[model samples]
Target: MNTPPSPPGAERTDGSSVRIGVLAPLTRPGWAEAGRHLLAGLELAVGEVNGAGGIGGRPLQLLVRDTAADPRKAAAAVDELAGLGVAALAGEYHSVVARAAATRADALGLPFLCSSAVLDALTEQPTRWVARLSPPQSRGWQLYADFLLGAGHRRIAVAAQPSVYWASGARILRDHLAPRGGTVIDLDMGALTPTAVCDELVDRRATALLLLVGHPEPAVSIVQSVRRDQRLTESLIGAPAGQPEFAEWATSLGDDGAAIPFLRYLPERLSPLGARVGAALRERLPEAPSFVAFEGYDTITVLADVLRSHGPDRALTADSWPHVAVEGTRGRIQFSRTPGISVWQWAEAPVQVVDRDPAAPDRFRILHAG
Candidate 1:
């Protein structure tokens, strides 16, 4: 159960292996598949690195732990991995888990890099032990705002899960709309009843909706409610999670709603690295892939690069490296310089507006591409 020790350049002078821990949601209710997808990406990265003669010829090993989207589990997992003496820690899509792990990592003085968690609060701590490789939620909001403003939607309603990311984005949207003579109506689903959500949307008379739910049921319910009562026919809908399932929901509600999904990378086509990642994922899980996959891939890639460049002996603290710029499956990645530094420079891929075709429920047509 002994973990790998750090060397001068993350190299093993004594033939010791470098253990990097990946903490993710493996058994969470709606996120099991996403967790699998993320693991698939990590597998590709490790396999590729090991196949290419390992990190500094010492072979890199991944220690996988299931956080189950639980903060306590996340903290406990870090304790276990830390006891094993892992050189570094990598985070997942669960921001709460990232926050918890960051706290522990900071206390232990271990370098922590976040791959997918985008909540701004994770980086608000005063320590330089954590670095986020994913862009902040604010950037995503700016993208959504730009998209909405360009589409001529002046009156907008934001429907979110009342999570950290959504709540922050709602405020940013409201602020951004203030100068343009536009209106931003905020809806926190966690506080209001589903029926109340429907009533509020109808009352706002908003011309567009920004949905922030991460699952299928709530998303579908919101759409149905909006369609049944709210005058959203002429309004545009934007979400970061508007996948095929949401389109199906729109069709089920008999609403030909326009949808825009703000994703991590632009261009729907896969990159060379993405191709390798996809193949690895198909072999491992063979189900639907989500944005978490890319997050995991980028996390490992960046960690490997840093470990290789810095070697095992150099301290891998957060302040040890101010920024990381890597070419991922999407594009260039640079961590944000915000005071708390919650976001990363992971290039958000182009957003596309898609609609569910009445003739083909499972199919979607791209009306716009960013």
Candidate 2:
């Protein structure tokens, strides 16, 4: 095994190190906590790899940058990381940021592994140095639609804020459910109050309401308002894996958070490794590890595996990633070389519908597995 020399800023006096650049929304308004969870998972994986003698006797060090969920910031971060000689890049939570970072990574010809961005277009084309562990937004919506119809929901009304994330989710749901004898109603959450939104859905006789707000506070408000109405209390209130998976969302909503089902990357049953990772994460994080944390951990572990097998050569790592498969905490971390989705994309990660326990907001129950 011919180990390549360490990149520019990665060579230490005592020993060589492989610097992995991590891009996350560490200080972003709506995504601060998500970024923290992502960083924590990455750090945990790096610690483990270093403890196990690292890759080829070179310890892994994370050079983290806060993208603030902004595309321009993400691009700048990539440039900085490249300048610092990072062997690979990973760990982004926002779709917009991930897309920008992916483009930059390809341009620089550096291997980049996306942890949790779900936009279908991110990996729509073949690229030299890009792959995603998270399922695309379209795939997630497919699972959500399946769960909804299986749970006997027909007249579905979607209330979503105006954002790329919300719009993509809403579009997928409408496209999947409309042709299946399901009535799909679209409401701009920005234009309606929680009360007005509830009234309109009730008037339209909606059996289910998909609250697609990105922010936790407003999502909780809408859920609370809708549940307060006696007419809407029986309605299946659901969110599309944004604020719903966060602990703060459930805690702020209190007892009202119960029974509000949401799509997430949690499997129906945790693997032994997944359980151990979850337990380890719980010790460090204020909340139990969510899907974002799992993504970060898996991304680093997969990157480590690639580095160990391919050495620190950027081109070799990029070329070899497509054939590399690692068992991630969520599931198998493998990429599909399909035409449209031309990357190493794990599109079949198990997603499930889960709801918070009213008595234990930190706990959740899997309602439906997809």
lDDT of each: 0.65, 0.80
Write model 2 residue lDDT over 1-370, tens digit each, in one string. Answer: 1112322343343336888888888773638888888888888888899899999998898777778778888888888788878888998888878888898898889889899888877744578688888877887787788889988999999887777777888788888988887878988877898899888887898899988776665776788788789887678888776566887776677778777777778677779989999899989799788888988999888999989998878998888766877887877777766445655687667777788876776788887776
Candidate 2 pairs with clashing backbones:
335-344, 335-345
Candidate 1 runs further than 4 Å off: 1-16, 188-196, 228-231, 241-260, 267-271, 279-283, 317-320, 323-325, 334-370
Regions of candidate 2 where Cα sits further than 4 Å from its true position: 1-15
On TM-score, the leading prediction is 2
Index of the highest-lDDT prediction: 2
Q: For model 1, what is the error of residue 253's alpha carbon versus the real structure, in angstroms, after optimal superposition?
A: 9.1
C-alpha RMSD of each candidate structure in angstroms: 5.5, 4.6
Summarize candidate 1's per-residue lDDT along 1-370 as a digit string, tens digits: 2222222233222447878877777774425556666777776677788888877897887777777777787788788877777778885767667888888877877778777766667744566667776666566566657667777878887777766656777787788877977798877777876567766766777778777776565766766666566454555566654434332344445543434434443347778977767666667654435556766777788888878877754265454446666777766656545644543334443445455555754455554555
Score every model by TM-score: 0.79, 0.92
